[model samples]
Target: MNWKIIFCFTLLSMLETSSSSKIYNVDPSGYVLYCPCMGRFGNQADHFLGSLAFAKALDRTLALPPWVEYRYGEPKSVQVPFTTYFKIEPLESFHKVMPMEDFMEQIAPTVWPPGNRTVFCYMPRGNPDSESCNAKEGNPFGPFWDTFDVDFNRSVFYGPLNYDVIHHNMGDAWRDKYSSEDYPVLAFTGAPASFPVQEENRRLHRYLEWSDDIDQRAEEFIRNALPKGAFIGIHLRNGPDWERACEHIDSTPSLFAAAQCLGYRNEYGRATQEMCLPSRETILQQTRKAIKDYSAKSIFVASDSDHMIDELKKEFKRMNVSVHRMPNPVPQVDLAILGRSNYFIANCISSFSAFAKRERDIKGIPSGFWAFPQKPQNIQNSSSRSDEL
Candidate 1:
C-alpha cells in the first residue's frame, strides 16, 4: 500500500478509537440516576448521603445529581452540578460516582439512548386511572430533567418494594427484583432515601468534603472577619414560612429535620417551639450562655430570614463579643464556617441546621439545638461528647 494511503487510514482508526473510549468508560454494571427534586439544599444533601449508600449496596455506579437551586428573579429552577459545592474525590472512596452531566454527555448516548429512558418510582402518582410515573410533574423535577435534556419514554412503578437499603435483605430484594443486566439504568424521580435521614446514613456525611473555594472562603472569613478568639456559630430558622410551620410545634413530636437533634427514637427530646422558632429573648439568653460556657469571643449567625445580627451586636456590645454574619450568604460556605466553629447551636427543626450539626458531630465538635433538652444548664452537657447532636 502507498505510504499516503496508510497515513490516512491510521489517522481515521485513531479517531474511531477515541470515540469508542468514551463509551468504554461507562460502567458495565449499569447506573443509578435520580433527581434531587425535593426541598432546598439541606433536604437534598441529606437525601444524597443515603442515596450514595444505596448505590454502593446495589453495586451500581451512582450518578451524582445536581443541586437544584431556586434563585430570585429566575422563573425556573437552576441545576448546579453536584461538584459545584463538594469534592467527588472523597466520595469515590466510598463508591463509584460520576457527575450526572458527564454521564449524560458521554455515557448516556451509548448506554441510555433517547426514546429508551425510563423514570422509576415507588408507584404511579396523581391520577388513579393513569399509570404514569409523572416523574417530571413537579417544580424541581421538571427543571432537573430539562437541564439534562432528559425525557422519559416510560415509567417503572417498582412498588410494594421501597428504597430502604438499610437491611441486608432489602438489598437482596432489590437485586432479585431488578438485575443490572436487564435494567441497566435505575432513574428515580426523587432521591431513593428517607427524609430526616436514616441513622446509619448520617455517618456518611464524612465523605462530603466542601469544594476548595468554599473551604478557603470559610477559613478566610474566620481569620479576617471574626474576632481573634473562638466564635460560636448558630443557625436560626425563623422566616415567615417557619413561623407558619412552628404553629403546630406542640402537637408535632418531631418537625422537619428534628431527628438530627431529637434522635430518631426521641431519646433526646421532642420538637419544641423554642427549638423551631425561639423568641428573640430566648435566642439572646442562649447566645449569652454559649459565650460564657465556651468563652467565645464572637458569634456567627446563619439564618433563612433576618438573622437579627444588629440586635445581637447591640446586646453583646457591652460584653465586647463581636457579632457577625456573611455579607452575601452562600449556604455551602455558611455550613463550612459553622462546622469549624468552637461550638454550634442550631435550630432543632431545620434541615439546613442539620447539615452543619452533622458535620460538627463527625469532627467531634460540640453542638446543641437552640433550647432543646428544655434546661439551660443541660444544653451544653447534653451536646457534649455525643455525635447524635
Candidate 2:
C-alpha cells in the first residue's frame, strides 16, 4: 500500500522545517544595543539622540537604555527606563526603538545568551595587555548592564573607526563588519555615537518630549512657584565640582560640553571662566537683559549648588521681578520648564545646559550662554553650521 514511501515523505518535510527554524527571536535586520553610560542625564540624552540617528542610518532597531542616575543616598547608580521620563512614540517617529527591559525579557534568551554575548567597542578601552572592551569594569557600566542581568563573555574591537555615524560611512562599515545574519545584536559597551553630539543630530532633540509625569511636575512648579507672566529660565552650573572645573578653564580650551556652545571648531570663540562659572553680577546682568527683551515678569534659576536665590531676589527687587527655584529640584522637571520659558540662558560648558540649549534651539526659541559674546562681533552666524550643537 506504499506505506514506506509515505513515511519517507513525512521525514523529509520534518527535516526541511527544522532547517528553517528561527535561531533568533529578533528580525534578520538586527538590533543596535548600547548603554547610555556616558555622563549625567543631559550627556546621556545627547548620546541617546545620536544613537537614535545611528540606528536609523543602519536600519536597525535601537534598544533604548535607561537614564542612569546617581542620587545622594544611593550607593550605586539607579537605572531608570527611558520611557520613565520621555515618551517612546516621538522616538519611533524617527526610527524603531524598544526599551532595554523589553529586549532582555523577550529577545535576549534566544539571540544573546549570557555566555555568548559579545561587547563591541570602537577600540581597546581597557588595559593594553588585556586588549578587551571591559564593558562592565567601571561605575555606571557595571550597574547599568547588571540591572538587566547582562554579562558579555567576549569582546569585538571595531576600529580604526569612529562613531561619526552621520558624516562618515560608519553604517556601511558596521554592517559590513558585523552582518545581522551572523551577529543578531551589536551590543556596545557605550553609546555608538560621538561625544559633544554631532551638529547634524542637534535637531533630533525636538523628538525628546517629556512623559506626562515629568511634564506635569514641571507645569505644577511653574504654576505654583513662578509669577503669572512670562519668565526667564536660566541654568547655573556652580556646584563645588563645577567651581573646581572652572578654575582650570584658562588652561583647557576644550572642556566638557563646551563644543555645543563655543562651536565644535571654536568658530564662536573659545570657552572662558565667565562662560563656565559666571559671577553673581554677570548672572544678574544677563537675567536683566533677557527679562527686558522678553518682557519676562519672573526668573527661574536651576542650579547644582546653593544658587543664592535670596541674592537674586534682592537684585531684581528694583525691577519688580520675582525669582524662583524648586524646593526639591528635579533636573528633568527643570529642563522641561526651561524648554517652556520665554527666554533661556545656560552655561556654555555644561552638558546639562547643553540639553536645554539644544531643545530651545529646536523650538526656534532664543537661547544665550552665560558671559558669551564678550564682543558684539562674536555672535554666532545665523547661517553657519557651526552654530549648531
In candidate 2, how many Å is residue 364 off? 1.3
Tens-place lDDT digits, model 1, residues 164-265:
888656777888888887888999998988776888998999999999989999999999999798899988887787788887766665666877777776
Best by TM-score: 1
Q: What does the lDDT come to for candidate 1?
A: 0.83
Candidate 1 at residue 113, lDDT?
93
TM-score of each: 0.90, 0.88
Q: List the residue pairs that clash in candidate 2.
A: none
Clashes of 1: 0
Instruction: Output the lDDT of residue 156, model 1.
Output: 88
TM-score of 1: 0.90
Q: On a 0 to 100 scale, what is the lDDT of residue 382 in model 2?
A: 28
Show model 2 residue runs off by greater than 4 Å: 1-25, 376-389
Model 2, span 13-89: residue lDDT tens: 54454322322236668888998877788778778888889888778889888898998888888998878899888
Pick the lDDT winner. Answer: 1
**Candidate 1: 10-residue stretch with minimal lDDT:** 380-389
